[model samples]
Target: MPKSLAEVEEGRTVRIVDVVAGRGAAAMLYNLGLRPGARVEVIRSGPGPVVVRTEGGTFSIGRGLAFKVLVEEEE
Candidate 1:
């Protein structure tokens, strides 16, 4: 099932399914290499920002931004 990036736990790897943000936010994420089908490992997720690491690099996505990122857990 797809879930917001903010809801994923640390150490879990997920594949980005979609980004439910406006053009600007989506474009920002896209520039960070967080587009659909991109795989990322959650480094931290809680009250603060949701940190994720992908092939491109690590990113600290704010809670609001994290919620806009829909992802599915990787098997």
Candidate 2:
């Protein structure tokens, strides 16, 4: 099942499935190396921004944007 990135726990790796946001938000996330098919490791997910590591680099995405990023946990 697909879940928002913000809900993913630390140490878990997930594949981005979709981004439910406007063009600007989507573009911003894409520029940050987050897009459908991309894989990200949850570095930190808590009260603050959710931090993730991708093939490009590590980044901190605010909870708002993180909620728009849908992903499936990787085995």
Candidate 3:
């Protein structure tokens, strides 16, 4: 099942399914190398920013924004 980035477990890799954030937030994430089809590894998850690693680099997404990024586990 698809889950929000904020809900992904640490050490798991997931593919971005959709970003439900506002235009500004979505644009910001896009610039940060997060978008549909991008593969990201969850480095941390919980009551703080969600840290994810992508080919571009690592980034810490605020909890609110992280919840807006929907993802699915990669096979």
Candidate 4:
């Protein structure tokens, strides 16, 4: 059930399963708390940065960074 963040619809809860970390990608996602095993809820996307609400707070993860984080939709 793992899918790239770009494949996930906004307003759904997803569990972070993997990350394709790179220099910019790592810092972007890490700053937004998108590491493996982290639970994130996709809030709003498109025409702007993809937003994710997590334990710490609401964070806007850009599509470029979002694509690197693989997540499974929560049931």
Descending-lDDT candidate ranking: 1, 2, 3, 4
Candidate 4: the clashing residue pairs are none
Model 3 alpha-carbon drift over 4 Å, by segment: none
Per-model C-alpha RMSD:
0.6, 0.8, 0.7, 1.8
TM-scores across all candidates? 0.97, 0.95, 0.96, 0.82
lDDT of 1 by residue, 1-75 (tens): 899999999899999999999999999999989999999999998899999999999999999999989999988
Q: Which scores higher on lDDT, 1 or 4?
A: 1
Q: How accurate is candidate 1 locally (lDDT)?
A: 0.95
Looking at candidate 4, what is the lDDT of residue 36?
84
Every candidate's lDDT: 0.95, 0.95, 0.94, 0.81
Clash count, candidate 3: 0
TM-score of 3: 0.96
Clashing pairs in 3: none
Question: 26 in model 2: Cα distance from truth in Å?
Answer: 0.4
Which runs in model 4 stand beyond 4 Å of their true positions?
none
* Candidate 3 least-lDDT 10 residues: 24-33
Per residue, candidate 2 scores C-alpha lDDT tens digits across 5-69 of: 99999999999999999999999988877999999999999998999999999999989989999
lDDT of 3 by residue, 19-54 (tens): 998999999989988999999999999898999999
